[model samples]
Target: MPNPPDYSWSVQAQQPVDYQVSMVQGLLDPSNSSLARACGADGVRKVRCLVVVDDVVDELYGDRFRDYFGAWNIEAAWQPAPGDETAKTLEQAVAITEAMSAMGILRRTEKVIAIGGGVVMDVVGLAASLYRRGIPYVRIPTTLIGQVDAGVGVKTGVNHGHHKNRLGSYCAPTTTLIDTEFLRTVEPRHINNGMAEIIKMALVKDADLFELLEIAMPVVDAGMMADRNPLSIEIIARAIAGMLSELEPNLWESVLERSVDYGHTFSPSLELRADPPLLHGEAVGVDMAICVALAHNRGMLSKEDTDRALRLMCAAGLPVTDAVFTAELVSEALRDAVKHRDGMQRIPLTTGIGSVRFVNDLTDDEIERGLDFVSQWAAEHREETA
Candidate 1:
């Protein structure tokens, strides 16, 4: 009788994840039917959708939004929320969830569409993931960062306890619909902020993308990234493709030596600690600059490559250094990263543009040297920035 229940049962299964990133322009134009189709609009049946919109996006496109849905016979319940970094919080996610419930959204039939930057998408995705355990959601990423980076991935998150993305989930949206037209209204600096993520992908996985960025630097400098420009579309599309390629193989991130992590190692702390918190891309730019310095000191990156990398970032209106970024901060951030990456500092360093090498054995002295290099470079380029 005592040994009767000694046998143990084990369950093993593989959960398949499938999602798409659609590059649809004029998504909000009254004549466009892409969004209508995504929201389940058919010729005869009317569609009811609960849309979580950024306050800024709503303010800018509210009328057109109504017109777009009206033309497609979609009854949209507009739920506008703050779409900045501060809105990346658990409370905001809860608010979005509350909005979903009030709409009486059907779990499988109805989909929540998030219209804004990365923050709005994250909040909405998290809410959708938790409502009744799971529900499909759509992302119409307006910001550059959202379209190219955050919106392409399956991760949804909210900031907690003064930490960036401290509480999160890996829940892919039903689909992410990208429309560069929304960027026409985005501030230049905000657009540049998104370029940081694009640049990160270029520096680690695609040299050709880096070249396109360089070629387009002047256009970017002038803040003239019009959707009509094929070059601009190619740039964003390439970055998005490269990011997805890297991510698809390791969607769960079970392998921690991620090339996509090049600039993220220290950015979170600096990002959260800034008095006026840096844009996510700004913080990442600073982090990438540091990694460039680290790579240079390790003799992994050529001086020519280093200069090109930093100069491109500068031309794109990104900060390569922050006063708070120091050797001490580097050490602390790497330590935290080590813990996060399962006891190994899987720090991704650029061997050259479009290539990376992970180093687990980084010493404090090495980190100090990296910081020194950054200090020197920043000082050398001080006049350019001024």
Candidate 2:
């Protein structure tokens, strides 16, 4: 048979990718020209750019957007997408993708500038990834959640049929511009929502950050903004740095045992199941609270440390327990997470404040006990506060 005519062939593909992330003040300060800094002075002027603003953001600052872009001599098309979690759907992504297609966006040049919280970033990022087989995009995350966690990661996705981020891609933005000024306009509850993700980081990776949160929570609760409160700014900077430090090495999640997954293991299901869906970070806080209890039960975390962690969540205005977070829900979440983790429960748990350990073995009884512990803790704390 002539050795099957030697028809088999394979080619190795390797591509090195890098992007810039800038945390700036007054990104839209017309005089500042932050987009130029993100896209490059020359590139900004030359590229065909489209600005996709979150509807909420456009409502708040629409009048200034055109002037801001024109100030830098960058003529760009502006499109607004609804910025709610419900908007993170395939249909919305298709709409944005179609809009970009209509605009004649090129795969290599013309960039899509995503401006809003995590949802807008997710849908727009996914749209940018799909349009023309992947085009460059920039993120200007407007909410606290976006600034700290979502905006920094090389992940983009839309929820699918009651599943959080079931349809997603690892498409890094050309640049991420984080302006703390935007947080000043975010509602207090939303600020607390973002704090949940930061607290997750502190619990698993930085004891110092945890301590900082303990000190800064009171100020944050009292309306701390980066422009007004140095401590608040420091807390935000630490959280962003910590997140980037963890993500830079595992952009593709090549490692299954991830410390950054600390609060994510069981939250996706809970987040989707709630009637009035919990914000992403709120769901994460509940998951982290359960993990804290799990660690305490196993003697990996001291009861004192566990209480401190739970208390911090409360002080930050995050819920550590939810009525809907039942044993069945947890089991379903774990099942879903295991499937995603290649049939292993590489669940991240705290060994100590600022340190983590991964365990593949978790029991139904243990989860029930953890849930009970958190429920009791929540009731007791509520009584004390009352």
Q: How far is candidate 2 from the true structure (C-alpha RMSD, Å)?
A: 1.8
Task: List runs of model 1 lying over 4 Å from the truth.
Answer: 221-223
Model 2, 1-386: lDDT tens digits are 36555577799996567887887877778778667756444534454588899998998877776777666666688899999888899999999988887888777767888999999989988988788768899999999899898898889999999799999888889899988877777989889899998898898889999999998888684246547467787788889999999998888988888899999999999898876679999899889999999999999999899889889988888888888999999998999899999989999999989999999989999999999999889888994222
Name the regions of candidate 2 deviating beyond 4 angstroms: 1-3, 39-47, 221-223, 383-386
Please state the error at residue 377 of candidate 2 in Å: 1.2
Error of 2 at 359 (Å): 0.6
How many residue pairs clash (N, CA or C atoms closer than 3 angstroms) in each of the candidate models, in the order given?
0, 0
Per-model lDDT = 0.87, 0.86
Query: Model 2 Cα displacement at 86 (Å)?
Result: 0.7
- Please provide TM-scores, in order, for all candidate models, with all chains considered together: 0.97, 0.96
Worst 10 residues of 1 by lDDT: 219-228
